[model samples]
Structure formats: structure tokens, C-alpha cells
Target: MIGLDPWSPQAPDDPGLTALLEDARAAAGDPVAALALADRATERLPLPGTGRTAELWRGLAELAAVDLTVARTLEPHLDAVAILAQAADAGYAVPPASGTWGVYAAEGPGARLEARPGDEGRLVLSGRKPWCSLAEHVDSALVTAWVDDERRILVAVDLSHPGVELVDEPWVARGLPRVRSTGLRLTDVPGVPVGDPGWYLTRPGFAWGGLGVAACWLGGAMGLTRRMRTAATEREPDQIGLSLLGKADMALTAAAAVLTEASSAVDAGLVEGEHAWPRCVRVRSVVHDACETVLTAAAHALGPGPLTGEEEHAARVADLQLYLRQHKAERDAALVGQAVADGMPVAWA
Candidate 1:
């Protein structure tokens, strides 16, 4: 894992950024503190496709390497910032430029949050929203609700409003124990619309945001592989250990290569319109496979000793397991295949 840090060569030579990352690593155990750290990160981390896309994603990976939960908390907040900036750029009425934010666009069965007309021509949201992660902690959020039977729009809402209620749902998942992703019950909750109907999903930044999550996944894989490499170095490695190490290195290297290329494509203005969705699917699919490969390899190479004894290692493994589930796996793979079959331009070299 020595030469395998994805951002080592391309990472900016900024001592302050390095120091902030060290601080984030140290404060990984506390979600509240991590939220504050994420707020500070918004000011320093560059937005994707801002000529510093590589640095922005590298910062995310560095955060995940220490703790996936912290990365989970920070990644959404960073994405919310980027989304808001995009909305502002498009002349949408965005919320005040402050506070930690979360993006809650996940739609599920049994819930149908809707937006409708309200006083002063503002929008009001009602019904229930599912999978609102960090709902009780963040100050505000960018949530997607149906504007009509056929259209969905993204709106920013104040989480602390009386109309916003955190539903009591059983969160029994051991992974990411600190970040509770629960349902929100909104009763005529006032919200500021972020963009035109359907703009959120269609925007180019959507793909960039998806790729940012992949960077975190790559980092999580890097974390597990780092431990595997450490154990191999500490003792005389067995044939199986060497084999797993080689397999993991190959997976990580491939994932990193795709991410680097995707970042460049984004900054070079190649990922947009018809290209954005397919590109995101391709990159996420690659990183997700790499994560799964490393997960299996590390488990076999390190055995259950770390799982049973090391708190940090166990948490990292469980957190990454759940985090990677964000990718829809075969369903998403089908999307990539469909895109390819539909004559989407793929620069296969």
C-alpha cells in the first residue's frame, strides 16, 4: 500500500489541508465533531469540475481512509454545498450560504413527499420522505419531493422546523452507528426551491457527486488493503496472503485509474448531458467492484482477529460494507450496459 495512495502524486502540496485531514482522522469517532469538521471543509475543499476536481475528490478519499463513517457524514455535506453552488449558478433561489447540509434524494415505497403552493409563492412540503440520513443532526437539507404526479423537484428545508419530524424507526444496522438515516415526516414544511423541475438529477454536477461517493468507496478499500499490507509486512507472509495482496493491489490500482481519468474528463468539460449518467455509472461500477474485491481479500488475508479485537478495524469493515450498498450493484450495472447498447459514446481504450 506504500505507493498506492490514489492522490499522493496529484494531491496539492498544501500543509494546511494536510493538517485539516489529520484533524478529521483524529476526530472520526465523534459524528457531531465530524459535522463541524465537514462545515470547515466546505470552505477549503474545491468543488468538482472547478479545475481542482482531483484535489476535491482526493480530499474525500483521504477522509475515508481514516474512517468511512466520517467520510459518510462529510461527503453528503460536501455534495450539498456543490449542489447549492450549482443551483445558485443557474439562478435558482438557494438558502442562506451557511450551515451543514445533507442531500436526501432517496425514494422508497410507502412514502410520498410532495411539494405544493404556499404563501408568498414559496413551496411547502408534506407527506413523508424516506432515507433522510443525518436528519436529526444537520441544520438543513436538499430533499427531493414530487411536484406533481409526473415531476420531482429538489428543495432545501430547515430540519429544525416544527413541521419537520424525525420518525421513530428501528435503526438496527451496526454499520455507521453514529449516522442515523431515518424517515422524515413533513407537515406543510416551508422549503426554498433549489432549481427548476427535474434540474437536480439532470445537472452535470449530479454525475460529479456520484463519482465523489465512489472516491470514498475507493478510500475505504484502500484502508482495508492498508491493514492487510501491514499484517503481511509484520510477519512472514503465507502464499495466500501474498496472493490476496496482489489481487487487492490490482483492484485498487484499476479503480484509482478510472477515478483519475473521470476526474480529468469532468474538469475538461467532457462529462455532461448524455455523457454524464453513463460516465458516473461506469466509474461507480468499477470502484464498487474494487471495494468488494478488497473486502473479500482482506477478510481472508487478515482472518477474524481484527474483526474481533480491533474496534476501528471492525467499524471500518462494517461501515464500508453498508456504504458500498449505496451503489445498486447489478441494477446499476444493467444501466451501464443499457447505456452502452443505446450507442452511448464510451472511450474504451
Candidate 2:
């Protein structure tokens, strides 16, 4: 595995997290085992936008490099914690600590979840929540449900509640197959309001959390880049192999720079208000593009030998490709371009 970048301030020395990541790498094939490892990793992660935001992102990147699905399973758990933290800081109701958590805020075309007033002023959720990854595994989740047509509220729900139901949908994806993302069917499930309507998406931590996912993409790319580097070194030194290595290195370097700068900005409390969305869009786009470049370079350098013969390499390629799609590509770029067009400061200097 590629070690943390020593030059980055985001890279901190944590022996405990290091050992956990090593264990996670060893258990990459077993999703259940890896998720257990991720649960243990929760305490090790620092809340983003805090003083140790760099370390927080570094931990996420390292986890992703180990296994994208493992990272995927764990990231939402961390994000849920961050959201709860934000809510707590804002004097909102917070749920009792659970074993593991997930953030299930994805909406789809089917039935939608709604929060209704319950006994003793509590909220109860009912309806279907889609795109809930590890819904069967996590102990709880911070879910988003419609309070009305114009308002959606974030609520913390216990996954093991009697009213919660997991749909047995067949997940046939080749990449990250271990972490199945299915839908949840709720029947008046008890829930605690996390934040007010629109707070989940509007918070500064939301942007910080988005950047955390970008860090994972960067790590997955680094994993592929390492395979390319090893392939180039193991065999005869051809100009083509060297060129690919150079390409991967250059792309990763640029990605790391943007990630580091953005991470520092987050830690400094600079990612807030009107600037958060644009800044996050820029960092995510840059890192996503860099990951794409690295993937291409690695494929060219290592050829079909590793792709066919290596299980890990093939899995990483597929996993990275799927995970990077979370960035939304040109659709997100259009938002950034619009921001630039609207005269947001472009500090290239």
C-alpha cells in the first residue's frame, strides 16, 4: 500500500489508525469483517473542520486506499457523527450513542420517507428510503425524510427498530459488491430530529463531508498508481512504462496539492457560507479528474497482465471507477463554472 504523503500537513502519525488500516487491508475481501474494523476505526477519526481536520481526511484517504467499499461503509458513519456533532453544537436534539451509524439521505423516484409527529413530541418515520448502503448492518442512521412537500428534515433512526425493514433487492454491481446499497422500508419507525429542515444540506460540515469523499477517491487512485509503479520497477525499464509512471505521479501530486489546500481551508474555518459549495465543487472536480488520469495511466503502464491476473488490482480499478462517480463530473463542473461566472474570487495566485 502507498504510505501517507509525508509532505502533507494532512498526514499525521497515528500508530493506532495505522494498525487498523493494516488490518482492514488484510480483511478487504470480507465486508462484514472489514466493517467491524471500520467500527473500531470510528473513535480514531477526528471530526472534520476541527483543528485536526487534516488528520481526519488523511485517515479517510488511507482507509479508501485499503478498500473502497470499506471506506464507503465507514464514511457515512463518520459523516453521521459529524452531522450529529453539528446539531449538538447548534443546541438541537441528539440521539443516544449507537454502535455504528449511516447517513441515508439519498432520494429517488419511488416512495419517499416522511416524518410525522409521534407520542410525547417525538417524530416517527414511515415510507421507503432508497440508496441506503449497509442498511442491514449499521446500528443506526441519520436519515432525511420529508416533513412536507417544501420541507425535508434530518432524523436519527435506529436501524434495528421493529418497524424498520430492509428490502431484499439484488445488487448486481461488479465493483464494491461487498457493500450492498439497497432501500429501507419504514413503518412508523421511532426517530429523533437531528437538525431543522434544510440544515443537513446547508451546514458547512456538509461541504467538509463532501471533501472527505473526494479524499477517498484520491486514495483509490493512489492505490492504482502504486500498482503501476511496482509493475514498472519489476520489469525492464521501458520509456512507455516510465512515461506512465510520470503521468500518474504528476496527476496525484496535483490532486494531493488541491486536497491539502482545501483541507487546510476547512480546518481554518474558511469553508463556510456562500463559498463552501463552490470551493467543494472545485476540489472534488480536480481530484476526480486526477483519479481518472491516474486510472488511465495505470491501465496503460500495467497492461492486461495485472488486470487479468491480479484480483486486487482488478477490484481496485472497478471500485475506484464506481466510487469516483459520486462526484457527478460535468454536472458539478457546471456549478463551479457558474460560481466563477457570478464573480467568486479565483485565487490562483
Candidate 3:
């Protein structure tokens, strides 16, 4: 609510933040500018579900309107704020703030964090964390590691410490290349336990945070969809072209409506109930499917010229494809399906 647009030309808290936003807005392939923007976003990160749900969603949309890669890259750090808040609410002692934080709990084969507790509440984290976004750039991160054979614990790590290495080799995806997401190899990295065992994934806000990601995907898709709409209006289009445009418009409009409605529901404290996770899943699936349709229709309507020739449009499409992979699509849809099968009302207002 502070700024109407995330990428507007309004004065930021500082001149450096303004420059950072401008450079990030211009960054299509330049990862450095995007990194600077990521750093600036750290200063005033909001703790999610603290009644800023709608504002965070809108900010993601505005950022997506500029560069989806930058938006995707910065979103995890924002998610970290929410995760930290959840841990604190769960009665876990988070590490003292040094700088911005990220949530990197995604694991791959042979990935596990070993937590060795030291005297005076210090802990050393070692092992491989396979999927960390903004691993190298972020100052700290809330990492997940095996506390026991049965459960995982959340550790707040100072990424600037010695023996913390970011392995970019595994992050070979070109779609979100500017995001700098990679594997973290920690060799006795110092940290502090954030939450009790199994708090990170079990928290209610986890799914709600996932919805925030879907919001970004929706925003990116709408940005790309608008290009097709603009093209359809600018040129004298045939019926087929107009038909594709219409389809794209419908998908984008419906998705936006769902997002707005969800925002209102969130503001009304509707997401605090037992069905919150399922509801979040439903919203995410809707927006995700809508975004896929928008991307397809935009490509078919605008043709390959915008994709291969235009700089910004192509990047948006590519970034969206990569960003949407954050969630298990089919499985997410199946959750909603199962909920409906269990006689759970969707409250489809």
C-alpha cells in the first residue's frame, strides 16, 4: 500500500534503493543489477500473514510486470520473513538478525544438513542443501536439516561465514538465471536453531506463502497476456486472432478475479481456519492453470516474433515457465480434488 506500483518512479527510502529498483527493472539478462535489487528489497521485508497478504501479492504482481526473473528471485527472501515469523510464533528462538534471510529447505538426492550443537546456543551446520534460491547473495537463510532420523529442524544460518560455498553448477536452468539459485555446501557453518523439529513445513503459513508465489506467476502471465491483447487491438486482426485474444483475456481475467477475491478473503481473516491449506492449494491451482493458459494463448496470438525478437516479452515467458515449477502442479490439483471428494466445500463464492 505504500506505493501503488512496485516498479513506479516514486522516491524510495533511499537513493540507492531507487537506483537498485531502476536497474532491476532494466535487467533482462544482467544478473548483477538483479542482485542489487535483491539486496535493496531486504531492508523492509514484511512478515507475511501479518495483514499484508494483499499488499505482498500486489507487490509481486508489480515486480512481475517488470521482470519475472527478478520477481521470482526476490520472492524467497520475502518468504523467509514469513517463515521466521512462523517459527517465532511457534515458540522457537530465531537467530539474532544480521541481515536479510532466505528460506532454502528444498532437498535433493544425498542432500542433508547435519546440525552439531555447540555451547551457549551456537550450532554448526554441515552437509549439502540442494535447492537454495539466492544462496550466495542473501546474508542469512533458514535452512532445514535432519535433527533426527524421524524429523527435520530449521536452522538460521549466516551465509557470510567461513566454509559456506554456493555451488552454481547444479543450477543450470536458463529461465531464472538471474535469480542465482543454487546448491549450498556448508562445511561447519555457524548458525542457530530457529524453530523446533518439523516446524518449517508444518506451519500453516507455509501453504499461504506458496499462494504468494502463485500470485507472482499470475502477474507474470498477465503481463505477457497484455502484450497479446495490445497486439490484437493495435492491428486489424482476423477472427482467429481475435478468438485467441478473447480466450487469453478470459483466462487472465478469471485468474485476476480469483486473486482479488483471495486477497479480500485473506484481509477478512478467512485463511486462519483449518481448511486454510486446502483453500490456499485451490487458489494456487486456479491461478497456476490460468497462467499456463495465458502463456500459451499469448505465444499463439503474438506468434514467434515477440518470443524470439522482443527482449522483455520472451524473458517473461521463460521466467514464468521456470517459476511455476516451484510447486508440484499435478499433486497440488489432486489435493483439491481429494478435498472435494471428502465432502469438503470449496466455499466458491
Q: Which sequence of candidate numbers ranks them by TM-score, best first?
A: 1, 2, 3
Off by over 4 Å in 2: 1-12
Per-prediction TM-score, please? 0.95, 0.95, 0.86
Question: Which consecutive 10 residues in model 1 have the weakest lDDT in total?
Answer: 1-10
Task: Report the number of the highest-lDDT candidate.
Answer: 1
Clashes in model 3: which pairs?
none
**Model 3 regions more than 4 Å off:** 1-23, 38-46, 89-91, 96-98, 272-274
Give lDDT tens digits, candidate 1, residues 1-349: 1124552333447777777777887887677888978757887789998888977888788888878878899999999999998898888778775888999998899999999977875799999999988888899999999999989999999999999999888899888898898999999999998898899999999999999999999888888988988898899998989999989989988888888888888999989997688879989999999999999999999999999999989999999998998899889988988888888887782
Better of 2 and 3 by TM-score: 2
Q: How accurate is candidate 3 locally (lDDT)?
A: 0.73
lDDT of each: 0.87, 0.83, 0.73
- lDDT, candidate 3, 1-80, per-residue tens: 42323222246455654554566688745545555565466554445566666656766665676678777767776777
Candidate 3's TM-score reads: 0.86
Candidate 3, residue 197: how far the Cα is off, in Å: 1.0
